[model samples]
Target: MRILKKILIVLVIIIAIPLIVALFVQKDYAVEREIVINQPNEEVFDYVKYLKNQDNYSKWAMMDPDMKKTYKGTDGTVGFVSAWDSDNEEVGKGEQEIVKIDEGRRIDFELRFYEPFESTEPAYMTTEEVSNDQTRVAWGFSGHMDYPMNLMFLFMDFEEMIGDDLQTGLENLKSELEE
Candidate 1:
């Protein structure tokens, strides 16, 4: 009986230590990736700012080729929303709404996921002229994860998980723009 009690206490300590440490760990996360596209900043920004144009470069949307999509408002303007439902676990279901647009510079989106996970985040794309015809485009997302949800990150490689997707999307964007 005494040995079992000691084992139980040790097990509790092991789990509690990480949970206690996680409480002090930062909960905010942001992932940013950039690529250079051989195109004018205005042209690149114009293409990206349009919600419907995601089909041309969004890696996630391509994950489920037949994913059902619905839209609201003007696609290239602020207040535009593009929601998708996919049967694929990886693709899941989500909606992205254009919340802000800085013509020739940036476009901000509010991303809300409902299936496979429930969360919301802010995503954006920015374009900067690198040369007379080359443009640098940056894509990223940021959000806060409260308490226990944040703790899961300690056991996961957050950047490694999403970095590939962002890089692929950026590459696709560059290809589409250059073509």
Candidate 2:
């Protein structure tokens, strides 16, 4: 009976440690990447405002070329939604809706992911004039995990993972716009 009690205590402590650690771990994560595109701010904003254009520059959009895509409302305007489905685990299934637009400056999107995992996050892109023909484009994404799930942040480098994809997309965007 004493041995059984000690075994139970050891197991409880092992599990409790993680839970205790989770309480202090951050729940929210945000990542941003930027690039310089050889295009005017208006021109860059115009292209990014249209979510459909992402197919040409977004790394995830190009992940599965055959992924099914659907759209709603008018592109480049508020309330437009671009949804994609793919058999690839990395691509999974998700819908991104244009929540707001700041004319030639920025566009905000709400991303709802369904398959693989469920999450609703916010993403945005901003264009600023660097020179008469140069535009600085910034892409950002932020999400929050609940409770113990936030503990994953300790082990997972969400910033690096998501930032890499954002940087790749921005680099692709720069190439597409420059060409």
Candidate 3:
């Protein structure tokens, strides 16, 4: 009986210590990936401006290939919104609004997820002319996870999960833009 009590206490401490440590450890999770496309900046930027074009470039990373999408307001302009719902947890349910557009340079948006968690984050894509015929496209997302989520990240690899997806999405985008 004494041995059993000792073992239980040791197991509880092993689990509880990590949870306590995680609560104090605050870190921001970010992923960035860039792809060089064999196309001009204007050509690539124009394609990404529209929510409809997301279907073409996003197939590789989409949580749900058949997820329902609806566009609100203008299609390619700032203030345009894209909302989606999917059974896949990776994609979840979210709406993105075009927060800013700099012609062929950058597009910034706000992403809000309904399921999984009720939170919003900033997401954006940028394009720069590497040369006359090639353009560099970069996509990145940054968000903060508090308390238990920060601890969850200790076991979960945010980069491995999301970074590869970003790379795949960029490759798909490159293919579409070059085509």
Which candidate achieves the best lDDT against the true structure? Answer: 2
Residue lDDT tens for model 3, 79-117: 999998888887778898999998899999898889867
TM-score of 3: 0.87
Worst 10 residues of 3 by lDDT: 56-65
Error of 3 at 48 (Å): 1.2
Whole-model Cα lDDT per candidate? 0.90, 0.96, 0.84
In Å, residue 173's CA in model 3 sits off its true spot by 0.7
Q: Please, what are the lDDT tens digits per residue for candidate 1 over residues 39-128? A: 888888888988888898989988988999999999899899999999999989999999998889989999999999999999999999
Over 4 Å off in model 2, which ranges?
Answer: none
Best first by TM-score, ranked: 2, 1, 3
> Comparing 2 and 3 by TM-score, which wins?
2
- Please report, as a residue range, the 10-residue window in candidate 1 with the lowest summed lDDT: 154-163
Ranking by lDDT: 2, 1, 3
On TM-score, the candidate that comes out on top is 2
What is model 2's C-alpha RMSD? 0.5
